[model samples]
Structure formats: structure tokens, C-alpha cells
Target: MSSTRVGRGGRAAMVAAALVVAAGCSDGTPTGSGTSVPTSAPTAGGSVPGGAGAVKLTVDSTVATGIEVPWGLAFLPDSTALVAERDSGKIKRVSGGQVSEVGTVDGVESSSEGGLLGLAVDPGYPGKPYIYAYYSGGDDNRIARITYRDGKLSEQQVILEGIPAAAIHNGGRLRFGPDGFLYAGTGDGSDRPTSQDDNSLGGKILRITTDGKAAPGNPDGRVWISKGHRNVQGLAFDGDQLYAAEFGQNTWDELNAITPGTNYGWPAAEGISQLDGMTDPIAQWRTADASPSGIAFAKGHVFMASLRGERLWAIPVAGGKRTGEPQAFFTNQYGRLRTVEAAPDGSLWLTTSNTDGRGDSRDGDDRILHVTLGS
Candidate 1:
């Protein structure tokens, strides 16, 4: 695939040639390496383009299966995707229909909602060959850099640390923005007061260099990009606009347009509130309807994966503002959708969280689904 960075409207052009093959799965056991098991054909779902002139999309097939709580996905230049298992602390690669364990992150303290969470391939890979991962340690949630070589991961280096970690609310989503800076979404570790603290790292979107220091353009001379976010788990960019998917406490889940130095009302406001000095969400959904997690931008729309809601949402955007009602796809078809990523091929890749403790596990408890959007 070309290295050209496609504009928001040109995202569909990045779709690679499709290679249809039989679906395969790994054994039920938890092995760092997964073996392929022949499974039923890929199940297809989606709708024709309609509201807001959204592109037609179809969940055409399953890529890999038997994954245990696949959380983060990062692709290689050649279209190979590296998946991080949230509780296993293992990194697995899915190429074509084959799945194999690359390696596991040492010292990952897996608990409720912790362990290996997010993974991002270095924007400068092959030459740099570094893979960044956000995982939970004994004391806190931290970011580490490791090398991927010969199907193995080694040379782990802690890049950043000290973010609070709780059994829940350990926000863990990492991505490299268009500006080439590493951005992380962190939780307040269930510490509501920390969300409003500027001096603390938790409950903020952190912008930093690959070396772990704060990014140059940060509002302060530290990692804080924005504050007062309760627990943001999804981060993506559409053109120059950054969007975050936040889990609400009791009322509403939000999709907010992020800006540096801005405060997103957390304990002060669960969802939309015309509170003074606080930015409100562009779109908000009832907590039961949207426990939004990983999100991706493609073809002029932001796709969010819902865990508790058990669906995927397509929100159309025009000029940085949502243009129409969000469309729900694959509701209850795939149990607990966890992450949705725009592949190098332009198609959206989604991971299921069926085996993630909270989900209703099936034969192939977890899997990766491929989605293609078109007119």
C-alpha cells in the first residue's frame, strides 16, 4: 500500500484489494501463540448509505477468531495487524487468515480492566521498528517501547509511568496523531477528584514525544493536553479535528471534540451541560446505549465500538460538526464490540470482546471483523 496520507474524504480510496479466505480460529486454551482452526464462513452485515449521505458499509467477514479480549490493533505497512490482548499481556499478529503470537509483555499486572491494553506501531517503523504499548504494572499504568523482530518482542523500555490504575476506569487507548505525537487517553482510576486536577496525569489526554517527555506544543510544560475527562478510551483524528469517546458515570456517554487546555466536565457533568467554562459533547448517548470504547475516522465518518451497548456506531461529520443522527450497526450480532480501526486498506477492522469477563462467550468467543464502506 502507498504511504500517502489520505484526506478524510479520500479514506475510502485506501481500501486494499480484498483477499477472501476461509475463517480460522485458535484453540480454546490461552497460548501466547495461537493456532488456526477451520471455522464457519464469515458472516456479513451492514446497511446501504442513507442518513447524512453516509457511505454504504458492510461487515463482510471475520479475519481472525478465538482471540481473548482483543483490545488494541496497529497495522504494519504491508497490512499485517498486531493485536494486543487486554488480560493476556500477549501481542499477536494476524496476517491473512493466520494468527501467531509475537510475544508477551513481561511484568504486566492483569486485573479487572488492566494488563496489556493499547498498542501503537511506531509511525516510523522498520527503520525505527519500535512498538509502543500501554499496560498496567504493579503500581500504575505505564507506556513501554519494545522491538518486534523475528516474530518476537524484546528490549522493553518504560517510556512513561505513574498514571493511576484501578480495577476499573484504567483508560488505555494509544494513538499517534497527524502531528506525529503519541497521544494517550487515561482514566482517573476511579478517583473522580483527579479528573479536575491539572497537575495529575490521570483523567487527561496526554500528548508526548516518543521518548516520554511532553510534546512541544502542549499547553503546559507537561503531558496534559486536556483535563476533566472521567475515562476516555477512544482517540482518533478526522482531518485536523481530534475526537474522544468517553464512558459516562450514570447518565450519558460522549463523543467530544478535543482541544488543548480545555476542560470536559466529568463529575461536574456526566454528559451535556451548559456549565460555564466547560466544553460539552458534540454527541451524547444514554449510558445503556453507548459504552463507547475504541474509535476510528474514515470516509467522512467516525466509527465507535460499543462494549455494553453491543453495537457499532457511525457518526457522520461535516466541517468538524456531527451532521446527522448516529447510525447503529451489528447490534447484538457480535457480542460487545471493543475496538474499531481504519485499516491501511481503508476498510474498518473491528474486534469483539465476547471473552472479556463481561461478555457472553460463544464458540469463537472473540474475533476480528472486517468492514468495507462504499457508495
Candidate 2:
């Protein structure tokens, strides 16, 4: 790592070069994230918080027949679910207890860690009729658009190209902010210093328009939004607050509040810090416990998917600070947890990642787990 890192754009070429040497491998089934219903609704078994003490887990393997190395997931406006399988490059739709292959994406660069990674519905483009995707293509991270209507893909449009890619730090999570802008987390691709450089898109959380260009009113007139990140895979917004789960180099993974143009200190700092000009992390855990991936806000808590820790974390966020200790569930049951979302009905939807050439998975290992916390 350089003492003073080069700008983000300048070092992206290094990422492209690194991925070429390693190729071949990999791999969410988001089961929920719905609208507001009153808490008094009736359940078939009565409302239970679904915690370890209150309830037990029931994993479903019937739907696993169609998902091959599942990666990311999204929900349609009509309430149908779309899931991406990284190795298969196929997108599957689930509705009324049936999972169908809607379509397949081409040109996915399936290296050790590069492939179709993130899928997010356009919050503002809901009326425009397209879903967005983030994946590695030919060893570079890219964002594209697919017309996903009536549970099928009709048109495919490559929106933006030339994001840095490597076996690590591709920053593959995508989500829409409360402001209706697309936010993406990119990894430093082993060059940790690039995270602090603004000119490149790697190692940063990018705020972009629907067209994959940087949103207007940005502090710098480029795709770089917030610099100094290693491999941020989890993103969520609470009311108006922005939060992210970031993977650290060799130390602690972090939970942070996303602020525009503020550096979070990548090579110089791993977790929280008192150093000037370096943003501090709100919460942190050892890398062995949490190589945290997707995160979402639900039922007054922040839900996270852990890849290394093999658990789902329920963190409470309030007033831009962590309220208390997080509750851990599904520990080592499914292998590696990757994504989580709080559905409109209050159930926390979770996705798994053990099949992504990592984790010690059991039979029916990498599967989505739906928990009904209130009963």
C-alpha cells in the first residue's frame, strides 16, 4: 500500500489486472421487505417474535431446486420476488410458492469472487419499468439495466462500465436511499489505499442517478461519493439516515453512518478512530465474527447478513448511534448469511451465501430464511 494513495480512478486499472489471473467460481433469495400493516394482524400460529427463545427456525428446501449459487434479490412492485444466481447467471422469480426462471444474463465474469453480485429495484424508476444490477463482466465491475416486467426480462441495457474488479473488494451491494438515489459499495480490490482516493469508484459508496451517472448536487462532479472503504457489501437507510456495513482488511468489520464526501480511513484505520479527518465507525466486530454483507432496517432495528460469522445480526439503530448490543440468530445454521431485508409485513427476510465457494455449508445450506418476529 502506498503511504499516500492515488485517486480512485487512477488505480482501477490495477484491479482489472489482478482479476485476470484468477478466474472461475462462485455465487440471495430475499423472501421479504413489504409495506406497513398494523401490528395486530393475525398469524396462522399466532404472532411470535421468532427469536430463539420465542420460536424455532423452519428452513425451506423445496424452492432450492432452481437457485444455483444465489447472489442477490429484489422485490417487484406487485410483490413478486426476483433472485439472481451468480454462477448460473439466471434470474429467478418467485410468486405464490412457485419459483420460475425469468431470464439469464450474459457475459458475467465468474472469477473466484467476481460475478453477478447485487440486484436492486429502482426506487424512483418504479414507473419506468426496469430493475438494476451490479456484476463483474470480463473482470470489471459494471452496472446494467434489465426490463423486468410480468416476471420476465425483455430488454437488457448496459448502463455504466469500467468499475474496478478483482478477486476481492468489488463492493457489490446496491440499494436506493430515502432521497431516491442509487447507492453502491465498491471494494478497494486489495489496494486498500484507493479507498481514500476520490477520483476512483473503488473502495467507496457511490450515489448515482438512475442512468448510472453520478447524481447531481454531489460534492465532487464524479461517481465517487464517499471514499475510504475496503469492501462494503451492506447498505440500508432508516427514515432519512444512511447506514453501511463495511468489511475491513484484516481487523474489524464496521457499521457506519454514510455521509457525503467524508473519508472513513481505509489503509490508515480499520474500525473506529480518533484521528482527525477520519470518520469513526459506529459499531465494529472482529472479521471472524462478521464479514457482513447486505443490511436493511426493519421493526426498529438494523438487520445484517454475515458471511464469515454465519449468522444474522439484529442491531438497533437510533439517533445515528448504536442503541445496544445486537442480537445474533441462525448462528452457523445455514453457512454464510449474505443479505437481509425487513418486509412490509414486519418479517425479516434473509439470504445466504455459503455456496459462493466459501463457508462450510450443510445440506440445504445456502437458503433464504424468513422469520416472523411478532406473533
Candidate 3:
């Protein structure tokens, strides 16, 4: 194995009013940063936060269906997206509400939670015509680069490998940062000790170039930007600040404001421990209320997709800090939400994880949905 290092909204006015009242900030002002709320306070479909209150989601259409555990969703220069299947190792193209097979990633070994997980189109696409993937191989998890052209995939060039792999906690989510470098999230692989181990790549946020070497200016010339995470599957950027959603043990799930060279308390602190030298999540939820996987920033809010909680959470952010309480939407409406991505057309594309052996699969159990702001 090789090691590298680096480093929404809206709503009807009346409904928004109700939420502002419920939040006790009817004046439409934001609350404090790192605010923690009870999972029981804002029930599903409650008042949206002030920042997200003006925008409401309306499912416009189903873009694709019959996908076998679509885990990674990345958009091309043409606005069409490439979707990766976790279990099948296949990459599908979704455009104009039609789905077509692009290509399958080789050597993908699916287990409890590991498989082909994250996808990212080269920031300079068309010119680069390359796609990056994070997948679980037979012995370890790897990040590979593949060329796409004429609907075919060239042999994968493994850029990074040797991340620990386990049945449950192989963290896989990839995105090209605003800095033009690639970022990856890894889990502890159920080995709690690794979360705090600086030498281990597991349970760390890695920053690297497309070639998989540590990005320039990374702390200690290592690929890790931050460490001490359980299982991180959700990563989104609001301008320059990066936010991550991670799965917790039994007590809490976290939405942290990721900073380089920082240590996020994992095995030691589940939620708001206020421990010195450790960064706490800006917001957190009960484990049962939010096993958040994918998150996107749109409409002045961070939209988080919940798997175990079967809900979508909207957390209002202003100037890179949480301004209002996190609000839950469409609770149990879309079972096991996996990914939420903001589209070029100012809409959002969401995927369901019903067919992932966890949720109850409907006829169109696993599908990509097109959602837009409601009037």
C-alpha cells in the first residue's frame, strides 16, 4: 500500500415563519456558532432555518432508476453527471432524465460498507477528460484515475492506495477542492486506535494532487489535512471552508468545520466534549437521527443526506459559520438518502439508497431525483 498526504433551502413563507418562531429567533437573526440541538426538538418537516427558509425543495423528476447502490455522483463539463455504483462497480451517465452505462471500474470488491464510493471529475474537464474514483479493492481501499472518452474507460491508474478497509467503516468520498487539489475522506475501518494515529492514513482527510502525491503546502509534507474521524462519507465546500459529515458510534453524528492540522476527537469524544486541543463539530445530531453521508451547499444552507435517519437536514450558514439551528426536512419521505448535489441549472440532484440492503426498496427503490426550489 502507498501513503499520500495533503493538505438549499427554502420554503413557503408561512412555513418559514413557523420555523423561525420555533427556533425562537423570529427576528430572523442567526444563533451562535457550534450550536448543538436535541434530535427531538426539530421533528421531521419542521420549520426550516432562517437561512434556508426561503427555499423549498420540489422533486421535479426522476433522472435515473434501477441503479444498484449508486454512491458517487460527479458532473462533467457538459452538465451530465457520472454516477458510480458501490456494489456493481459500474459508472452510469445521467443526462436529460436518461441513464446509460459509461463503464465499470475493475477490481472493486464490495463488502459491508466498502465498494466503489466516491467520484470526482477533473476540475479542468474536457481538457483533462479524466475521472477520479475511490473504491475498495480486495486488500485495501484505493483512489484511481481513469480516462473517459467515447463512453469508455481506460485502465485505472491507481494514484493512492493502502487505506485500511473493513466491512463497515471504509470511508470513501472524493472531491476536487477549490484549490484544484483533490481531497479524500477515510474512516477508521472499525479500528478505533487508527483514528488518532498520525502515521496511519485511515480516519484522516487527505489532500493530494491528481497523481496522488501530497498536495503542496500540506502540514509536515503529509497527505493528511485533518485526523481522528470514525467514518467520513460526506464532504462539501462553502467557498474555501470545508465541511464534513461523519458517522458516529452510538451517541452522535458530526458535521464538522474541517481545518488543516487539526485533530477532531473521535474515540475520545463523541459529541461536544469541549476538550482542549480538539475541534468539536459545528453541529451534531443523534446517531439515530442522522447517519449523514453526502452534503451539498446551496441556497445559503448546507444540505445533508441522512441514511439511518431517513431525512434531509438543512443547516444555515453565514460567513462560514452556523447561523441558525439545523432543520429537518422530508423526514422518512425518501428512505435512506445517499447523495445531494447542486446542479449547474440551480437545482439539486438527490439519490436514494433503498436498494443498498438497508432500506425498504420500492419499485424505483434506487434512483436519482431532480429537485428544485419550490415557489
Candidate 4:
């Protein structure tokens, strides 16, 4: 699957619409001994020629039997997916026609935004087999590494620690970059100002070695990659370009393409507009089109987890820009959509956030959905 971000005419308009909507409120670790070698800038797949209004994905099916308050999810090397249960602090393996909890992790602070939030598999996994997780800790946020061996939890170890925590805004998302390092997005623990402080780790996109130590090439000596974020819950690299999903505070939520040492305007700025040297969002929406969570790049589209909006938005992204309107689908049909992962089998793995305290829950509540790309 190839992927890239865009910012042209139609894409520009879609982003502008998102901002207009937001005027209201606001909102990787690597693998084993060696990290996954960085690949060339990714080529977004599901290619559909032309500019904005190019293409979109359809929801073929939704899996509901075996999930609860699903937060973050990652597709395994074997094409399966590991999904997190936000309230239960459990990791479940979903594949074939079955879903089962691999096991419940310990030391997870599962209250409100705490609990298991984001996940990534060791890039070398299946061959090396290790899983990385981001969860809310008693007093702060923490990263842990464990192995999903034969559907059970094995080798538990906390690799990173010391992030701010509150009942909400504990950003918990992790991804293994092509560079073979682990990248993490953290929240300000309800303390919005911390995102702008260099010494602080909250509300920033952090980069580190596969082993959880700060990467040698870090922009700052610490793990802080870029600061000034209010609450960022989604992180993805479409090639060398790293894009993030940020929650706006009473203003606009944003989708930004990150550059090394780039200051993404947060608490300081809501939606768009160049503020001094701070970079603005390539696209954004009123905390409504967005409230975005786990993000995935696949089939030439950027799939975002819209929490407050109760929708799975398909933004036809190309060359780093949005092509058309934020296609709002699954609006409350399945409650909140929290995570999306591109699957090896040419499909998608998504998590429902229905049971996440603020959403509407059903008998099945949260579950992982496996489906074909939409037309």
C-alpha cells in the first residue's frame, strides 16, 4: 500500500470547511536489535487519479461480538490486528471470524482517558514478536512492551514513563516508523500550557529508539519531537512525512504534516492560520468533523478516528492535502470510531469507541471491525 499527503484546491476547501465547523469548542518504538529500515516516502495506495473529490472508502462490514471500549489498534505482521480495550486494560487479538482477549495488562490506569489507548507491533515481530503499548499510569502516562505469544501476554516491560495524566487528555498512541524507531503522541493531562514547554513531554509527538530510549537524532535531547500541542491522539508516517491528529481547545482540531523540530501550534492556536513560525494544519475541522483519535493511511485515503463526531471520516488525501469534503460516514451508526489500521490483506481494522464513557454504548459496545475498502 502506497500513501502520500496533499494540499491542493479541493483538498484546501475541505480543510477550510473543517475549520469553519470548529469555531466552537476545541479540543514508535522500533523493533528488536535493529529497527525497521526507513523506506522511501510512502506512496498512498487505492490510487484514483485527479485532485479533490477523487475517491472514498465504503464500510463493507462491522465486527461487534468481541470488543469493549476499543481504543487503539495495530495490524500485525501476520495480517491480524491487536486492539486495546480502553476500560478493561486488555489486549485482544482479532482475526478470521473470531475475537479474543489476549490478556489483561497490569499497572493500567483505566479511568476516563487512562487505560490502554494506543498500540504498535514490533516491526520485526512475527519474526521477533513483541508488542508496544501506550497506557495511562497511576500518576502519568507510560509505554510498555509485551509479547503476544500464542494468544497470551508474555514478557511485560515498561519502556518509557513520566508523562502528565488527568481524567482526560492522556494521549496514548504509538507507531513503529520505517526508521525502526518508536514514535509516541502524548497529552497535556488537562494542563494545556504544558504542550508549549520544551522540558515537558505532554502534548508532543515524541520519537525514541526501538527500546524506548530517546533516539540519538532527537530534535531535543529529550524524547520531545515537537511541542505546543493540546491533545494529539493520532500519529502516522505517509512516507518520510509524519502527520498527526490534534484536538483543538474550543476551536479547531487539526491534521498536520510534521517536519523535524517543527513547532505545531497548539493551545496557542486553534485551527489554521500561520502563527509566527508555528506550522498550521494542512487540514482541520471544528472539533466536530474531527475529535479524531487513531489514524491510518491506506488506499490513498487517510482514515481518522472521530470520537466526538461519531463518524469515520474518509479524507481523500493526496500529496499531503485534502481533496474534498470530509466524507462523514458511520455517523453514530456504530457509535464512535477510535482507530483504523491498514491491513496486509487489502482491508481495514477499525475500533469502535462506543463504550468510552462519552459515547453511546450498545450490547456489543466497542468492537473491532474488519472490512473491505469502500467505493
Best by lDDT: 3
Which digits, one per residue and each the tens of the lDDT, describe model 4 over residues 91-133?
8877775787789878886865678888888888777778888
Question: Where is the poorest 10-residue window by lDDT in model 3?
Answer: 23-32
lDDT of 4 at 127: 77
Q: Give lDDT tens digits, candidate 1, residues 242-353.
A: 9999887655678999988999988798778989999998888766666789999987788889887777888887556787667777777887888999998889999998
Q: Each candidate's TM vs. the true structure? A: 0.87, 0.83, 0.88, 0.83
Off by over 4 Å in 2: 1-66, 124-126
Model 2 Cα lDDT, one tens digit per residue, 244-289 = 9987655567899878878888778878766789889878766666
TM-score of 3: 0.88
Candidate 4, superposed: residue stretches over 4 Å from native: 1-53
User: Quick one: ranking by TM-score, best first?
Assistant: 3, 1, 4, 2
Estimate the TM-score for candidate 2: 0.83
What local distance difference test score does each model get?
0.78, 0.69, 0.80, 0.69
Ranking by lDDT: 3, 1, 4, 2
Of candidate 4, the 10-residue stretch with the lowest lDDT total is 28-37
Candidate 1, 137: how far from true, in Å?
0.6
Summing lDDT over every window of 10 consecutive residues in candidate 2, give the lowest-scoring window. 24-33
How does residue 106 of candidate 3 score in lDDT? Answer: 88
Between candidates 3 and 4, name the one with more favorable TM-score: 3
Give each model's clash number: 2, 17, 13, 40
Best by TM-score: 3
